[model samples]
Target: MKILDANDKELMTVRKIERDGNTLVIRGKIFGAMPMVARLTPKEARAALKLLDFKTFFFLLTLLFRKG
Candidate 1:
């Protein structure tokens, strides 16, 4: 998955996601340069989850299974 900045420019390309204990590890790159990792604590994870409500969750599911 690719992350875009506020200006819609490429910020980072997520390479992998892993769970470490109570943290969610996101491995990615910035500007296609050095590797970067984001460790989201449980609190932060919950905050992020709030951004993906039920309707959005189902939308993502549909997109995932949609045929071109």
Candidate 2:
């Protein structure tokens, strides 16, 4: 997955996502910067999903629908 700014410039790349036991591992990079990874347990991931702002979610939905 690719993250873009409002102008549609690529900001980050989501390289990989994998499950390790009860946790989810996310690996990605910040544009022009070092790579980063994060691990979140199922509970934490669910909470984070709930915290997504409406505009961001709408932007993502637009991207999806446009592609389809």
Candidate 3:
């Protein structure tokens, strides 16, 4: 998996992805954040994983924000 900065600069990467039960997980580190675990349920994690691309994700957010 690839992690990047706001400017789209490559920060770090993981050789593999891992999952356990309902949780999706990743390893490695970013510029400032620690080597940490973000646990999300199968459904929640799946929805989130679908938004890995920033462009589409932000577009959704912008649409929501505009509506709100």
By TM-score, the best candidate is 1
**Between candidates 1 and 2, which one is better according to TM-score?**
1
Cα deviation at 50, candidate 3, in Å, is: 8.8
Better of 1 and 3 by lDDT: 1
- TM-scores, one per candidate: 0.68, 0.62, 0.44
Candidate 3 has what TM-score? 0.44
**Native-to-model Cα distance after best TM-score fit, residue 49 in candidate 3, in Å:** 7.7
Q: Which ten residues in a row have the lowest lDDT in candidate 1?
A: 59-68
Which 10-residue window of candidate 2 scores lowest in summed lDDT? 59-68
The deviation in Å at residue 55 for candidate 3 is 11
- Which lDDT tens digits does candidate 2 get at residues 24-53? 898999883879898999889789779889
Model 1: per-residue lDDT, tens digit, 1-68? 99889998998999999999999899999988989999999998788878998999888889978885
Stretches of candidate 3 off by over 4 Å are: 46-68
Report the lDDT of model 1 for residue 22: 92
